[model samples]
Target: PSVQDCTICMERLSAPSGYKGPQPAVKPDLVGKLVKCGHVFHLHCLVAMYNNGNKDGSLQCPTCKTIYGVKTGTQPPGKMEYHIIPHALPGHSDCKTIRIIYNIPPGVQGPEHPNPGKSFTARGFPRHCYLPDSEKGRKVLKLLLVAWDRRLIFAIGTSSTTGESDTVIWNEIHHKTEFGSNLTGHGYPDINYLDNVLAELAAQGITEESLAQEKD
Candidate 1:
């Protein structure tokens, strides 16, 4: 087998893996392969990676980004409610609006968050997000539902907008919270909002490919 350097430590596969992570040392490090992706890493490095994550029993191969199990998120406790509204967005006048209501209250952080026991800010409650109730929009909604189930919609960390730490913030995906207006630039009437959000979702490893793979 052709040996590759450990991506985490930059050491040869044959060399004993080094320890430079946050975990305490106990045993000598060895190497192993992620059975699905065939990506190799030091066993210690893999354990460190897992420990640094949500510890949700799923791991992504760092090299290929292949997921071994369901990917959970660092979103705090919240409620995701959705319903159809009678109003139509600017660009899509043919269909009604699908309103998503995300309600997360201020609470202490858990082990999944950055600082456990520290209070996190929930700047907005019942934040309204919008989408068209069309075929493609419904498809996006379905995937977003999956994203919600995996808690990928929001996360607890530093707020980029306010630069506040220990706060509830949106993840990499963006949402169009404005409806029936585009004055704020966050509103619709732009023709590419749905496609853009879909691309953002894909960046987070949520896409039609994941939906197709779910059936298998």
Candidate 2:
């Protein structure tokens, strides 16, 4: 049998996984291949990696970052609403605007949260976001809807602005909180915003191609 390195443990596939945690009672040389990326790894190494994570019932290939299953987050219950506005943003005067509203309230953290049983503060409610009503903007809206469904929109964590912990904050995905101008740097007029957001969404395993795959 050909020998290959398990990226997770940095060990040969022919050897037992170098995971120092509790070991699974499987063959030392047993290897498993991820279905989507087709990257192979020692089964024990994969199990160890999964255990180290949030155990969210999803696996990400370390080599290529290809997600195996639906990746959900611990975002608390909230509402996401969007509508077409008649106004045009600064640089996107050619089309109307798409406004997104996210509303999350204060609540006790669940077992999946960082501080379970502790109350979290939702400083902002009904936060408004904006995007141009163009073809690319609409594509971003569709993917944002998917991200909201997966609870990857907001999470309870330390606020970078207020230095307060246990508060509802935006996840890795960025949004245009400013509607008219780019004063806060989160607004429009930036030509790369759409493409940058698409990359961010891809990082979270939410892309148009992935969405189509789910439908199929």
- Number of the top-ranking candidate, with TM-score as the measure: 2
Per-candidate count of clashing residue pairs (backbone under 3 Å): 0, 0
Overall local distance difference test of candidate 2:
0.89
TM-score per model over all chains: 0.84, 0.87
**Stretches of model 2 off by over 4 angstroms after superposition:** 1-4, 25-29, 209-216
- Local accuracy of candidate 1 as per-residue lDDT tens digits, 109-150: 987788998998899788999999999899888888878878
User: Per-residue error at 87 for model 1, in Å?
Assistant: 2.1
Segments in model 1 whose C-alpha atoms lie over 4 Å from true places: 1-3, 22-29, 183-185, 202-216
Which pairs clash in model 2?
A: none
Error of 1 at 181 (Å): 3.7
